[model samples]
Target: MCFGPFKRVCHWGPLVALGIIKAITFSTVTCLSQWWPPQQSASGTLVFVAFSSSAVLTLYFFLQAMFTGPGVLPAGWRPEVEGDTRYLQYQKH
Candidate 1:
């Protein structure tokens, strides 16, 4: 039913989601900036707003990787082995 190293699930899903979210955020920010007051335009406020938002998203992914090792692997269907001597022997000391 699945393919490749991670089976059917892969990093592509998250990458696509991030792309959509970033596009939406960028569009919303651009729209809002068009209506900002003249004084605000000269202050670089909109640029800072967009930059910080993107930075936060980038930082969040790094933090997530730190906390969670990686994507979940599909469970293998092999029968459960409990206290098997051969299984225990295979483990590195």
Candidate 2:
């Protein structure tokens, strides 16, 4: 279903998503500079910091999700304890 983690970056969908992210970040910085002017206003600086931090953190989390999935349970996997299979048996809907 998937390739190696680094190779995953080569896929088109994610590449496009990353490009979108970069574009949005660039546009946000551009807008902040024009209207808020981080250099001239404390509020602007704080807003920039907040937005930038959120963006960076978003990338960080995204990287984690992309590279190493949150967690997975193998298909048909079962607990080791005896009689557990009975608990797992559910009628097909």
Candidate 3:
């Protein structure tokens, strides 16, 4: 998929994985809600809390992955010269 603002291209694999994760989370929450005690006054609150927490965690991880830099190049790797920067092809703005 294309991110319009960033002008970046993202592959479909991550999107598919995210959809699968959301589906699993919803299924789990549904199961939990059904298994919760019917007599309890807090069943709805419990499910809400569970779902919210899951969403929050997922967002946290997504942000973390987005913000983290790609990491350094291999050890001892260096360009031939200052004017020769062909190796630095993926510099971010």
- Per lDDT, the best of the predicted structures is 2
Compose the digit string of candidate 1's lDDT tens values, residues 1-93. Answer: 545534323467655766776787677667666766435675567565666678577758744654465554354433366545344322245
| Every model's TM-score | 0.38, 0.71, 0.50
After TM-score superposition, the amount by which residue 46's alpha carbon in candidate 1 deviates from its true location, in angstroms, is 8.7
Overall lDDT per candidate, in order of appearance: 0.58, 0.83, 0.67
Clashes of 3: 0
- C-alpha-based local distance difference test score of model 1: 0.58
Across residues 1-93, which tens digit of lDDT does each residue of candidate 3 receive? 456533221556656766777888878767766777434658766766867797779867875675566688885576879677765666556
lDDT for each residue of candidate 2 in 19-79, tens digit (9 for 90 to 100): 9888999899899888888989999999999999988988888778788855656777888
RMSD of 2: 6.1
> Which residue pairs come into collision in candidate 3?
none
Count of backbone clashes, every candidate in sequence: 0, 0, 0
Q: Of models 1 and 3, which has the larger TM-score?
A: 3
